[model samples]
Target: MFLRKSFTAALALPALASPALAELPHDWQLGMQPAATPVMVQIEDFHRLLLYIIIGICLFVLALLIWVMVRYNHRANPVPSRTHHNTLLEVAWTLIPVIILVLIAIPSFRLLYFEAAIPKPDVTVEAIGKQWFWTYAFPKDGNFQFDSYMLQDAAAAKAHEPRLLGVDNPLYVPVNKVVEVDTTGADVIHSWSVPAFGVKMDAVPGRINHTWFKATRLGTYYGQCSQLCGANHAYMPIEVKVVTQAEYDAWLAKAKKKYAANETPDALRVAAQ
Candidate 1:
């Protein structure tokens, strides 16, 4: 009976993990986060291709070094060959690297095109980077906006949120639908990055940069300012929640009512004055 129960629990472990809506960096995580978007899939493919090419090059160099040491060392050859150079060997080395470079450039161009071409997005969110927090606005969805601040340790503990990553309000978008994020910095320069979406763009003052993603999974994704912005740079965490269309619609309605009244944060207002 005890053996049967252990087997049943083992089978249920995966089931329990599937419903977890959060996807944060885990201890001893290897490689990138599991791709949650089509762009990320392409990014991972490109990464793997590069990794294979790098490994092949390293192995070939190692083998050549070993052959030279074994066949032409002082004890093995006593004297080195007097041949100045071999045209064929030189051409082979140069041409091989060129061919390898061209091969890499092909997929690289495709991936860049994929990232640059924004689809007809169902939702658009504009993120403005402040000193240490993020403010998001849904211009197409009633123009409602809100500030998202990182929760303190006690606050995070009470809310069951991850340290330094939890926010008061997380941007929401529908799964399997394109969402464009327009970012700008209100003060100095900042960056909005999300690894799961394979989207990272600088937010420069007086200029807006945009990136898009279509989340294939329903979960929470987090990122921080990849660029060095200010003193509290590390505290600026971006949180996004991908949900079903119905849930997104519901959140939109509630957000419009809640945030439409006072969209501008008090800090921004003070800075303006």
Candidate 2:
């Protein structure tokens, strides 16, 4: 009976793996995040073009070096070329690099504008970085706020997931909706970075930096502090949960009720709730 059950489980393994399981967190092995949104896709294409140009120039220079070593060696030419300069070669080298820079600059400028230019954001959230945790506030959504902290090792083990990277509270946003994030720091400098969304902005004390992204898929995306701010910098991770609009609204309503009571100390308001 045990053997038959094991065989059946093995047969069902393929079906059990869903789309979410196939798409893991972004890492260096894949170069960049999988291009899901339009901006990210364009950025990925621009990166590929830049990579090709760099590789081509490197290979051309390497080939020239190899040719010079073989054709102008002491045994091959006995006497070295005494020419001070080659006008054509110098001009070609300078002009080629200029053209390459132009090629790289055009797309780089476009990507910069795309990331910096603020669009009609569907929702806005404020992320404040503390010493070792993050506090998120949804000013437009009933003034809801929550504190997010990294999951402990024992908790992560029970959940069968990695520790530190997982958090207790995750920022929830609606899929395909533009989310504007205003980040600031309470104590020191921090960075909010999520590779899947291709959004990273610094959180400075007493000042706010803005960045935006529209999630193309509904899933939980994880990120960590890109800057070294404090002793527990590695412990501060960011988790974003993207859901449908209906689900987001439901969660918002619940969060508002839960946090609203604690936000105000008015006895009347607390009693009414």
Candidate 3:
């Protein structure tokens, strides 16, 4: 009976895995986060490609160094060969790096094009970066906007949100839909970034920059201000919740009502507070 119960529990574990959203860096995390979007998957693939190339180059250099130390040491050869230049060796080294650069350039350019080309978006959210917080507006959803502030120690704990990554309001989008985030700085320059989605664009003053991501999974993703803007730059956090289509629609409907634009900035700040 105990073995039977253990087997049943093992079968249920995979179902529970979906609800356990991924978190930020824990102790000694050396790898990139599990990708939640197609762009991130491509980013990881590119990274792996570069990693292989780097490892091969390092190993080749190490082997060459070991060969030199063994073959040309004073104990091994009393007289060193005075060879200043080898034409073939010089050409081979130069041509090999050029070939490697061409190999790396192909996928690098392809990925850049893919990231820059914004598809027909299902939703657009404007992220305005303030001094110490993010203010987001759902222009497509009746211009409903609100400020998102980082929750501190006790506040984050009570809200069940991750430390330094939790915000009072999180940007929401439907899973498998393209979400274009238009970014602009309200004061100084800040960055709107979410690593899981592989989206990051600078929020410049008097200019609108944009990036898009289509979340393939339903969960929460987090990022922080990637630029040093001010004293409380660390306090600015960005959170995104990818949900089902039905849930997204319901949430948008409620958010449209709850966060109307007619309210003054002070009123909105108070409401967010």
What is the Cα root-mean-square deviation between model 3 and the actual structure?
Answer: 4.5
Q: In candidate 1, what are the lDDT values of residues 104-148, reduced to their tens digit?
A: 999999999999999998888888988989889776678678999
**Which portions of model 1 miss their true places by more than 4 Å?**
1-19, 264-273
Comparing 2 with 3 on TM-score, the higher-scoring candidate is 3
Tens-place lDDT per residue, model 3, 80-151, is: 899899999999999999999999999999999999999999998878899989988776567678899999
- Each candidate's number of clashing pairs is 0, 0, 0
Question: TM-score order of candidates, best first?
Answer: 1, 3, 2
Assess the local accuracy of residue 190 in candidate 3 as a C-alpha lDDT between 0 and 100: 99
True-structure lDDT of candidate 1: 0.87
TM-score, each model?
0.90, 0.87, 0.90
Pairs with steric clashes in candidate 1: none
Angstrom error at residue 255, model 2: 1.3
- Tell me the lDDT of candidate 2: 0.80
| lDDT of each residue in 1-273, candidate 2, tens digit only | 999999999878764543242224544575875755567777788878988987987899899999999999999999877899999999988998898899789889989999899799899888888899988877667766788999899986665445677788778889899999888887899999887777889988767788998988877777888879889999999988889999999988888887775342232223223
Q: How close is candidate 1 to the true structure, as a TM-score?
A: 0.90
